[model samples]
Structure formats: structure tokens, C-alpha cells
Target: MGLLDNVKSKLSPAKDKVSHLAQKHEDKIQHGLDRTAHAVDKKTKGKYSDRIQSGTGKAKHAMDRLAHKDDDGGSMSPPPAGGATPPPPAS
Candidate 1:
């Protein structure tokens, strides 16, 4: 096997274990994501509430996909055709 393939083979077991652990802790992760976004909003004095919420939702969705990679790799569905694009990440 090529070097990259060999590396992937070695890492597959670790990846599976991580996915399993993430699935087991999914609820905790979701709660923590919510709490973190809420706290950030509070700290920002609600100035970025909408942005914070949107980002957090995306993150949770990504995590869900990661924890269930057999379905899809942590991807949020594409936004509606007419919907605004998500803002770029903060620098």
C-alpha cells in the first residue's frame, strides 16, 4: 500500500473509537454547545446573539455528522436556494 493508505489503515481503528465515543457523548456535547453559545452571547452583551446561535447550530450539526459518519461526514445540509450565505469565519 502507498504511504497515505497505510497511514489511513492504521488510523481507521482510532477513528472508529473516536466516533463511538462521540456518539456516546452526543447529548453532553449538544448541551455544552448550547451553553457555550449562550455564554458567549451574554459576554458580548447580546450584540452577536443571532450570529452566535447560527454558528453554534452549525457546530452541533457538524458534530452530529461526525459522530455518525456512516450517514454523512459532519455536514450541514446546504442552505435553501434563496437563503443568505453563512458569514465567513471570524479571523
Candidate 2:
């Protein structure tokens, strides 16, 4: 098997498990995201309110998609691009 295929096969079960968990605990996940965003906003003293709000919205949307996986248990929805908002974490 190709390298990608082999890795995918090995990780398939784990991925499915995560998808199931996400679906089951979607509310908890969203709450955590909100908490994180709130903490960051507090730390920044609202200086980046607009940017932070935009980023938090994107993050919540992405988490919502993950929590509602498709029939194949894969994430098919694409997240909203941040555009000029907070840049994504560097790889």
C-alpha cells in the first residue's frame, strides 16, 4: 500500500472514534471554545474585540461542522477563511 493509504488505514478507527465523540459532545465542545475565546478577550482587554470575535465565530462554525459529521464520518464542510482576521496557527 502507498504511504498515505497505510497511514489512513491505521488511523481510520481513531478518526471514527473522534467523530463519534464530537457528535456526542458537541455542546461541551462549543462551550469550551466559547470559554477559550472569552479568556483571550479578557486577556487582551477588548483591544482586539473585532478580530477575536471574527476568529471565535470561525472556530465555532468549524467545530459545529466537525460535531455534525457526514454519512462517511468525514468532515466535508470547509471552514470559513479568516481572510484579514487572525491568521491560523503556523504549521
Candidate 3:
């Protein structure tokens, strides 16, 4: 394999491990994100409230994607509990 392919092969296991952890602790991860966002907003005294909220929303959306949860309330469902076939993407 080429250099990039070699690096990707070596990192595959680590990536899988991280993905599993993220899926397993998705709720806790989301909670931590919210808590941190709240703390930052408080510290900033609402000056950047809008920006903070936007960033927080983006972060939560990313976490949801990582956890394979559908964002749009469309027919697409969340990943099955057993980690079988993943759900389809929303339109």
C-alpha cells in the first residue's frame, strides 16, 4: 500500500474504537456539549449568545450524525440498537 493507504489501514481500528465509544456514550457526549456551551455562554454574559447557540447546534448535529441518528424528522430512523444495518439518510 502507498503511504496514505498504510496510514489509513493503521488508523482503521482506532477509528472503529472511537466510533463505538461515541455511539455508546452519545447521550453523555451530548450532555457534556450542552453543559460546556452553557458555561461558555454564562461566562460571555450573553454577548455572543447567538453565535454560541449556532455553534452548539452545529456540535449537537455533528454528534447526532456520528451516532447515526437522523436529524430531519423525516421517515429515516436512527441506527438500530443492535448496530445492524444503518438507517437510511433523510431527504
Which candidate achieves the best lDDT against the true structure? 1
Candidate 1, residues 1-58: lDDT per residue as tens digits? 8999999999999989988988999989877877787677767877886787678767
Pick out the ten consecutive residues of candidate 3 with the lowest summed lDDT.
82-91
How big is the RMSD of model 2? 7.3
Q: Which stretches of candidate 1 lie over 4 Å from their true place?
A: 71-91
lDDT of 1: 0.71
Question: How many backbone collisions does model 1 have?
Answer: 0
- Between candidates 1 and 3, the lDDT winner: 1
> Could you tell which candidate, 1 or 2, scores higher by lDDT?
1
Top candidate, metric TM-score: 2
Query: 1-91 in candidate 3: lDDT tens per residue?
Result: 7999999999988866776787899889877877777777777776776777667766666556655633454244443343221222222
By lDDT, highest first, what's the ranking?
Answer: 1, 2, 3
For candidate 2, the per-residue lDDT at 32 reads 77
Stretches of candidate 2 exceeding 4 Å from the true structure: 71-75, 78-91
Please list the C-alpha lDDT of all candidates, in the order they appear: 0.71, 0.70, 0.64
Give the TM-score (vs. native) of candidate 1: 0.67
